[model samples]
Target: MSPGIPDRRGLWVAVGAFVIWGLMPLYWHLLREVPSLQIVLHRAIWCAVLVASWLTLRHGRGWLREVLARPRLAAMLAASGVLIAANWGLYVWAVNAGHVVEASLGYFINPLLNVLIGVLFLRERLSAAQWISVALAACGVLWLTTRYGDFPWIALCLAGSFGLYGVIRKFAAIEAVRGLGVENMFVLGPALAWLAWIELGGDGGFFSLRWGGWTDLLLVMGGALTAIPLIFFAYAVRRVPLSVVGVLQYIGPTLQLLLGVLFFGEYFGPDRAIGFGFIWIGLAVFATDGVLAARRRVVAQQA
Candidate 1:
């Protein structure tokens, strides 16, 4: 592969991952009858199983050994695991509780949050346009809060947790699949315990036959659904530029926003639109700055 040339296959893979993430609200909506906590537990447990199995098969325990050798990395993965689990649980609850629109808002805010995180924690400097973009996003959030007479905590929490998770992973310095596998392993104990308690207590949704085979299948497939896109993302990032990935990430939230409005039929009145419009403009500024920065880097490299 030439420098500055994207791998077409990787590009498609990245698109697939974002598309899956975007369409995930519909998947969770199917399990609306299941408790959000239970759904999250199932996701954690199954995702761990799938990721571990794949890692073991691919590297035959070498990856595990590599991760175990670095205690600091292991600890970082644990924190990231907790953050990701919280994100998953909250997102599921929000979707089933008819807050899909708000959930989408969280993801929409995530990239900007990532930028803020870079500035705050990583000591990375932001350009003037980047600062403007972040300010606009803040104003949008403020508009939504004051106009709607409620705080947008859901969006904030999601963005905060996921943004921190990304930062932690950035410092972890491990392969993405292996890092995720370790992260999930750290949470697997609690996840399994919760699942076991519910099943033993007869509160389990799986195999209850209440929602029938379809629900059971969906619950199990949750693991694959959780891990596969991440795998695709891992593959894509190695081959594609981070700027392209950043732009593509909006696909997921955009799809979620559409689903929340057109399919799930959540409220999207003029007020909401005005606030979102602000944030959208901010994202436009942010993304444009990123693309232009990437182009400058490429030009410098060519020179």
Candidate 2:
């Protein structure tokens, strides 16, 4: 049987990556003692150190030489670097500010936003169901705004930042590790400069002198976890269909929602649930359309 064609392992790997990433907010919340800007700075700094070390081990000093050889690629990836930095900073800020649940909402909206990005930026056509999905998600967001007495800015920010990252990465051609290396370098300048100034006697409280002690060494693994899954995702993207990957992304956001509501004990009330309802219905439509369209393709092939 050969395990029935292990086709979705790559999809599963990507999903697993999202799950870990989604639940990461809980870990980020622990560093709440640090300013969100500083925490963002740490994410970029640690990511740079981790990726640089990997490149050093793999390529030795020539890693720098390789990067210098591709100045155009480096410049393009620099844009990706800014995108992820803003995404990281916003996510950490959201979690620390007690908006984990809303942050989950942002991820919920990401897929729908991706569709729009495709249409607007790439001039791609949207299916009827996709148009409906976008409308439903927008309506849900609007509903959340109406019920909550304010718009869910955290959710919107999360969706917007990550969605933009995806858009830019699509245009940037480079290997995963090399691309990430350059992207991290984009924020490294501002991140290191900010941290240095804070360390010079400002009240930034730069280092977590008591931060979970040696356990914080595990915290440094944050970059590894971040990068490894991305590598897996890049592999999976080439192997799996985008439609499958899109649905699988829900698993990660779902885990994040659970972690936010259950583990972190963030509040989730009726209005938010209603918003989730709208998003779910929209996904249901989008998924059904994709499945049926795939079936039609198979039938046409046979015909």
Candidate 3:
């Protein structure tokens, strides 16, 4: 509650959210039999139902109308919705296709990519240390690409789509929950229609039990899985410093990387390790600069 102290409850909440995100690969793995497209559709539909219900209860029907009144904001949310949906689809597909290591690489690259986005699109300037961090991350990607004889497109796409989504949301000027609710609403119709089409064609995994009752339950619970962490994140950011959040964000991908290598048994030879090492060093640099900058600002305020 003090100027510099973190709220203990918020820190825990932030940890919980990132942990859930980190463990998400396991959740999707449970639905491995279900097609990735179907999983994504179910996620979109159920998440929309839950989030819209919450918004309706909290702010009533007028909340949506209020957002729609701003055509520009609505359009931005629509664009963001498509990007997020694409991100979700790609992530789920990658996990099911035995690319979890590469997927984790995407999230690892995300924070640095966000910094690059700020510099390029927002015209923001970075410190020399920040520039070095970006360069290091770039070198990591290059190392993986050249050494492996394969481009890390899956990782790059995931980071790029999510990064652009963040940029759009930055200027959207809406509450996180409300913005997400609106975004879901934009995609809900198409998701529902796709699911319905599949079900009618008797190829759906939901009630048909093609993958059994547990699959059905997981599919439905996907909504809660999708929304709860985001809600927690929204709550946490309001209480904690951005620098703290920046550091905490890595917990998710770290767990994911572990799950990929340890649990999923994906390949991780020395070549890949060297590349990841470069990125990890870059992240360390970026995080240190962020903390020092935050401390400087606090000291200036106190002085």
Candidate 4:
């Protein structure tokens, strides 16, 4: 495909990925009975299995060889693996513990955190509007903190881990699928160990007649749940503009927010609404600036 040409198929694929992510809370909600730690352990194992299988079939070990040969890349991926695993574990616990709204808030703040990382670590400059957006988001967080009488650590942790993960991957110079495959491999060992311990304790969920077969199957499907959207994301990014992807990324959090309020019947009082309103205003500025900037760049190129 030409670099600048838009493809409908790619757009659909990307949207599909974000939609799956948006609706993912419901899936985890179904497994609320399962321990969050165990759920994450299974997620790590099955994600590794699925990703590694796809990588092997697609390239017959070429990508793996390349990754292994690069010690720095492998080290970076190892760190990323740990971060992503923590992120997954935390998110699972948060969802199961009925912190879905806070979880969604984390993702909402993630893009802004990413911008902050870019400024701090990459020495990138931000526009005035961008600065305003960041300030608004900070105020929003403060609102939430004040209302809750404590720091929104769950939101902060999720944003921090994922934002840092994005930073590491930004410089890793690896393909998305392969990078994820390698990262998952690093976590797979611990995941297997955890599962073994659970099994030894006679609490393993796999093949348990007590837990319906459907539950067991859904647990297995966790691998696909983890991998498929990433695969779609990988496919989409190659074809779509970065700006488009950035906008589409919000779909996940939006869906999570709605699901929290409507489906899960989580709290969303006026104070919380005001806090979210501030954050939403910040996001509006951020997204508008991004879209306008992208358009200007495009127009300048054509000129």
| Model 2: worst 10 consecutive residues (lDDT sum) | 1-10
Backbone clash pairs for candidate 3 read: none
- Overall lDDT per candidate, in order of appearance: 0.93, 0.77, 0.96, 0.91
Model 4 over residues 1-303: C-alpha lDDT tens digits? 544445889999999999999899999988988889888998999999999998999989787878989999999999999999999999989999989999999999999989998999999999998999899999999999998665889999999999999999998999999999999999999899989999889987778776788887788899899999999999999888887888889999999999999999999999888888988999999988888888888877778
Q: How does residue 274 of candidate 2 score in lDDT?
A: 92
TM-score of each: 0.98, 0.88, 0.99, 0.97
How accurate locally is residue 1 in candidate 4, as Cα lDDT from 0 to 100?
55
| Cα lDDT for residue 211, candidate 2 | 50
Candidate 1: where is the Cα deviation over 4 Å? none
Ranking according to lDDT, highest score first:
3, 1, 4, 2
**Per-residue lDDT of 122 in model 3:** 100
- Candidate number achieving the greatest lDDT relative to the actual structure: 3
Each candidate: RMSD to true structure? 1.0, 2.9, 0.8, 1.3
Between candidates 2 and 4, the TM-score winner:
4
Candidate 3 residue 301 Cα shift, in angstroms, is 0.3
Clash tally, candidates in order:
0, 0, 0, 0
Question: RMSD in angstroms, candidate 3?
Answer: 0.8
Instruction: Kindly list the per-residue Cα lDDT of model 1 for residues 99-175, writing each as its tens digit.
Output: 89999999999999999999998999999999999999999999999998779999999999999999999989988
